[model samples]
Structures are given as C-alpha cells and as structure tokens.
Target: MNTKLPKLEPITSEWMFKFINNYELQESLFKSYESPINIHSLDAFSRNIKEYQEILATYNFNSKIFFARKANKFQNLITAAVANGIGVDTASYEELKQCIDLQVSSDKLISTAAIKSRKLLELAIKNKVLLVIDNQDELDQVAQIAREYNIKAKIGIRISGFYYEGNKLLSRFGFDIDDIENLLQNYFTEANEHLFNIEGFHFHLDGYSTSQRGESIHQTLDLIENLNSSKTSFKFIDIGGGILMNYLRHQNEWNLFKTELQDAVLENREPLTYNNDGLGYTNRNGQIEGDLATYPYYNENSKASFLKEILDTTNDSSKAVYQRLEQLNIELRLEPGRSLLNQVGITAARVAHRKVDARGNHLIGLEMNMSQMKSSSADFLLDPFVSYNNPIKEAEPVEVYFTGAYCLERDILLKRKIELPQLPEIGDTIIFVNTAGYMMHFFETEAHLFKRAQNLSVLGRKEHYTFDDFKTE
Candidate 1:
C-alpha cells in the first residue's frame, strides 16, 4: 500500500551533524553494544543551558530556571545542572534526595510531586527544599510534618486554571481556582501561618499556549494582589513547565499530510494502516479525520525562545510579564523539561531481523524494545535516521515499519511507515533523533528480562569521537 507521509526534519546541532556523519564510529559503537544505546551530548546540553541563561538575562526581574529532572533519569544531566548553577525540579522522593546528594543546594531544588509521601515531606523540610503544595490536603500534611519537625516549610500553592476540550480541568495535580479564598481562610490562620511559608503561586499547564500562559500569570498576579491583606506572604509566581519543542522541522508538510489523510479516509480511499485505530482520530461520520494522537510536533516558539515569547507577552496595558514581575517586586520561576533538552540526546538501535508481515508490509525489527523510546504520547513523530555499513545495491526504495525485539505484537518502535533508500539488513543502525527529554527514560523498563539501553556521553569533535558510559543510577 502506497501512501503519502509527512516529511519530518529534526532540529539538529553541530555535534549531532558531526556524530551522524561519522557512520564508522557509530557502527563500531553499535557493534560493541549488546543492547540499544543512547548517545548524549554534553556540549549540546551546555549550549541549551547557555541559551536559557542568555534569554533570561534580557529580563530585568528576578528569575530562576529549574531543570525538570523527570525529563530524563540520567544523573549526568543533574550534575550538569548543578555545575551550571541552575535549579532542579524533582517530582519524587528519591529524586529530591538524589539532587541533594549530588551537592545541589536545597534552595535550588523544587519538589512539586503531586503526592508527597511522609518521607518526601520530611526530607524536603529537613533539607529546606521548596515544596510546591498541590492541594489543601498536601498543605495540611506539610504543616503537620513541619509542626512535628519544628521547622518552617517553604512552600508554593499550585493553581489549576487551564481547562480541557469540554472545559474540564486539565489535571488533578492542582487546586481549583475558585477554592483560593477557602484555602486561604482555612490554612492561612495565625496558628498555622508560621508553620509553613507560603512563598508563591504555581500552575502546571498541559499545552503550550503563550496567551493562556500569560492569562494564568495574570490570574496568579491578581490572586497575589487579592491576598495583599492576608497574613501569608507570596513573593513569586512559578509557571510550571509546558514549554513546547519543535520536533518536526517541516511543519507545513505535517499539516498537509494530515489534511490529505483525512480526505483519503473520508473519500473511502485505501486507509492508512496504523497498528491501532487510536493512532488517528475518527470523526462522527465514521471516517478517520486525522492523526490527533501525536503532540504538536512543530511549534513556532521553543526552548529559550519560547520563554522570551512568554516574557514579551502583554497581559495588560500597563505591564508585560517582566514589567509585572518588576512592578510587584516578585520573582518569576520556570521549570522546563523537554524544551531545555532539545538536541541533547538520541537513541540508536541495531536492526536484528527483517521480514514481510502477513499483510504484505515490510517490517524491520530492531534490538531495542519499544519501552526505551515510548512516552505518554501515542507515537514519536520524528523520523528515525538509518545508517548502513554496506553499500546499497541501487534497488528501488522500500517503505517499512520499525519494530522492537519484544515478542508483543504491539511493540512497534514507529507506527508510521518510513521509506528507506534500500531494505535494511541485519547490523544496520536505526537512530531516533532528539530523544533526550521524556523519551529516554519515561516508561522505560527491562521487560522480558532484556537489559535496558545504556547511555553514552559523546565528547570531542569530528575524526575523534570519545564515548563515556553515562551512569543512570
């Protein structure tokens, strides 16, 4: 079955180009690896950090950049964040403890986990880490822990303002906006006020809408103003992370592909064979509309530039984001996960076998499991770059789906069919680009007793590629 697919161009850095061009080095590395491997670039990560710092410098107000640690579980990234003097956003008990053990200052760490266990709360209070209280119940727990430990818990309240498609709350992580007054009246009493320090407000949004973000900021600012007479102090606004990353370089192609696919399905043309119907959207007419399962693969603003856009956005006539923060004498804090990790890492797998499926579809099985690259999203849209050690026989190009070594029928690496210059043979390497963020470790497991992929830190330039094992533990 022939179908038109969107051509995706991945964002690449100088180091990535050098690494991809050095096929000999990559082949040698893959041949040595018993399992799939992830190549991380410290240079690329450093460049991303510098970009954030440079953009943040343009604003005149007090701001802090917190690297969301859940983006990737690699310990080197945390070390890099500490070395760069930036803060870390940890969502787990072990994550907070690990950051502290890595020598990261307690003030530079923010624990925003939804359910903070007693052990996590105790650790946060004992270490003086900033806790982003999710709800009144969590606040009570923190207050109790603080009263028990006789230490003031520095905390921020997370607010939920964004709504889903049907005006439903985006997530259960934050308190409803209407409950602000009730929360203040119940918890901000003189008896419990000194037990915890209500330092600021935070909201974690699901999408990357600058206007929505600005609106949230305005709402938070209004809340702070409303609490002017309250006993509790609020000094900052933590707009929790949802910074968009442009994974696809050719966005128009993606849009056009979606339109064409919808038209095809509506016209009763040969349907695009997805592993599951959930991969694409089905309209009321029983026609597949488009692929709604994927994230916004192409965004206008991403990484440091997105932050600049948010800062430049005007929430009111008198104040832009920076102006508002300055006028209120409050700090602006950000926790960016995926955007900060743009072009920092990639996952490479060796082709183990190739065969024609029962439906006449060509399938290339890679040694890596799907869990290694899977995230909460339905499928990773970025195209996998293939490298062949042997020369092609000048045969016609073939479209094939990449599957994993797992025995499960649904263990496909990429749901979409990708056209290769030639059919891949055993030992060829399939490299998925820009996978450093949530793709690397999120949902990763050693299922079927197969060992998890090893992470390698790439160093140096062309002609001399040095590799170091990045310890995950």
Candidate 2:
C-alpha cells in the first residue's frame, strides 16, 4: 500500500542545512565516531541567544536570560551561554557544581533543583548562587547550610496555584500563591532575614498561554507589592521557561495531520500513526474525546514574540506586565531551554536493518534507541533527513516505521509512519534536526549496556571541515 504522509519539515539553520547536505562529512564523522552521534553548532546557539537579548534590550526594565541546563547536558553549551552574558539555571548538584567549577560567577547561576540535597545546598551557598526554594523544608535546609557557612544564601521562593480566568492553575513544584504571603511573614522575619536573602519570586507554568502567563505576572506582582516592606524588597520576578518555539514550516500540514489522526483514531480512514495510536485521543462511545497531548508544533507566535506577548498582556484597567515591571524597576527574568537551543544541534544514526514485522508492517531499524531522541511529547513530529548510502541504485517507494535498538516491543523510535522514496539500506544515515533541546540527551540510557551516543560540538562549517573542527570529550 503506497501511503501519502503529511510532512512536518523543520526550520533549519545554515549550519544544520550545511551538515545535512554534506554526505561526505557525515560519512567521515560516522566512520570516526561510529553510528548514532549528535552534532551541535555553537554558532547557532549563540545566534538564538542574541535574538532573545535584542528583543529584551528594547524594554526599559532590567532583564536577565538564564539558560536552563536541564534542557541539554552539554558542558560546552553551558559555558558558552555564560560567556555570552547570560546566566545558567542549574537543577542538580552536578549541574550546579559544573557551572561553579567552570568559574561561573555566583550572579550568573541559580539552583532550581526540584529536590535539593544537603550537598547541593552547601555548594549553592558556598558559591552564593540563588537557590529557588520549593517549600519550607527546603528553606530550613538552606537556613541550616547558611548558618554552617555563616553567610546568607540568596534565594527565591517559587509560587504556584495561580488563578487565571477564575480557575486556579495547580502545580506541585512551588508554594501556593495564596499562602506565599503567610509563608513570607512566618519565615522571613527580621531575625531570620540574615539566614536567607529573598531575591524574588519564581514560577513555571505548563502550557503556552500568553494571557494566563500575563495574569500570572499580575498576580505575582500583587504578591510582591503586598509583601514589600523595609526588610523585604523583591528585585526580580522569574516567569520560568515554557516559552513556545515553532517547529513545522506549514500550518495546513499540521491541521491536516490532526484531522487525519482523529479520523484514523475513529476508524474512518487509514492509520497515520503506527498501530493507530490515539496520542491522547480516545473514542468515548463513538465521540472524539481529549485533545492532542503532544507539543503544539506549529506555533504562530514563538520565542521573542511569545515573550513580548506575555509582557504586553494587560486589560484596559491595568498597565502592561512590562510597563508594571518598569514602574517597579523589577528585573524580568526568564529561563528558556528549548527555544535557546533552537536549530543548534541534530542527531544522526545509521540504519542497522530493514525488515517486515510480525504484523506485516515495514520497519527500519536504527542504530540508536528511543531514549536517545525521545521527548515528553507523543512523538518527534518533524520529518528526518535521509543520507542514502547509494543513491544511484533504483528502488521502489516505501512507507516504514523507524524502530530503535531497545529490546522492548514498544521501542518504536517514531510513532508516525514515514514514507520514503526508497527503502533505507543498512548503514544509511538518518538525521533528526533541531534535537538539541530535550530530544538529544534528556532520557538517554545504557539499558542492556548499549553504549550511549557520542555528543560532538561542531565548531564551524567550512569548505574543508575536518574532524578537528568537531569537539568531543
């Protein structure tokens, strides 16, 4: 059956397109580093940073962009981000220590780890990097560590339970917004102020809604104002990252795919996804229920514009969020992970085998595992670039699902069935672009003792690019 699949072509950077088109370079790198290698471009990363900085520079309020380190674990990118005049938002002891060891100044780093250990607290206090406390337990831990070191640990309290449009948004990460004032009154007394220095408030919302975020900002501002006093003055409000970034080139394609997916789920058409996976859609008594659970891949307003929208969010009665920040001289801080790493890296893997599965579905086996390129989304929706080992040979068009190295039955690399001009041969290269954010190394593992993919940072794209141009540990 010849199937016509919807294409989600990704927006690529110059370096990414160059590397994708360079078959010789890919062959050479795969030959040297073996199959399943991730290549990142520092230049693309820096350019993304500059875009955000330029957008923020237009505003009057002081601002800082902290690169969330949990997005990608590359040390090179972390150091490069700080060198570009941004801070690093470390989430763990290792993440914090690495930044400190790299000589990242205390001001350029913040520890926002969900679970803070004693050692993590000690390290953050020693380095004087801001620690975003989740609860009173964390606060007490920081206080103990500060007393031991005889220095106040600068910290921020994370607030949640934001009410937007008369509904409260719930999150397990931070203190409830309603109780923040009470918590402050109890903990941040004049005597206890010496133990912990309150820097500001922080929050991370799940979805990409500008109005909700703007309302969140208004609520946080109100809390800051209510709690403002002689011993307490907030300097910044961190609307933590969940900034949207566009991935697909066409909106019609995304729309069509969604329609087709629903139809496929309802058994009204052929399955677009492997095994007719619902992807959060369910047939509840012959009616479609639940929305697509995947990331909204086709964003109309993303990155800087998305941020601007949030800042410009205000009703007629109140000032814009940014204007209020300007009036109060509050530094607007954001920690962007995926958007910052946009077009910065791609993961390449060689085809290991091609076969027909038990259910008569064509499966292309890749050298890598699902975790190597997996995200929290239902699927990585973008079409992969293929580098055929032999393009001269004539072949038939084939539609196949890419499988991974894991032994489990559900280790399908991509849930979507992709149509190719020809069946991929053994040792052919499959390049998944724009995977630097959470796709590359977020959940990579060594289950069954398979060696992890090597991560190499591509220094520059030149005419005679050699292995020396790629940096690998």
Q: Which one wins on TM-score?
A: 2
lDDT at position 217, candidate 1: 81
Clash number for candidate 2: 0
lDDT of 1 at 260: 55
Question: What local distance difference test score does each model get?
Answer: 0.79, 0.88
1-473, model 1: which lDDT tens digit per residue? 43655566677767766666667777767666665888787767777788888888877788888999899888888888877878999999999999988889988999999788989989999999989988766877888889988999898889885533336445777888778878888767888866988899888887777777876787777788888666666889999888887887787877865665565556544444354334566655775655577777888778777787777767547578778888888899989888878888988888899999888889998998989998887778777787777757786788888888778888888876677788888987788889998897898998789887887776445445644423333
lDDT (Cα, tens digit) per residue for candidate 2, span 216-273: 9998988877777555989999999999998888999999888888888888777878
* Pairs that collide, model 2: none
> Could you list the CA RMSD of all candidates, in the order they appear?
2.6, 1.5
Model 2 worst lDDT run, 10 consecutive residues: 1-10
Worst 10 residues of 1 by lDDT: 464-473
TM-score of each model, in listed order: 0.92, 0.97
Q: How many residue pairs clash in each candidate?
A: 0, 0
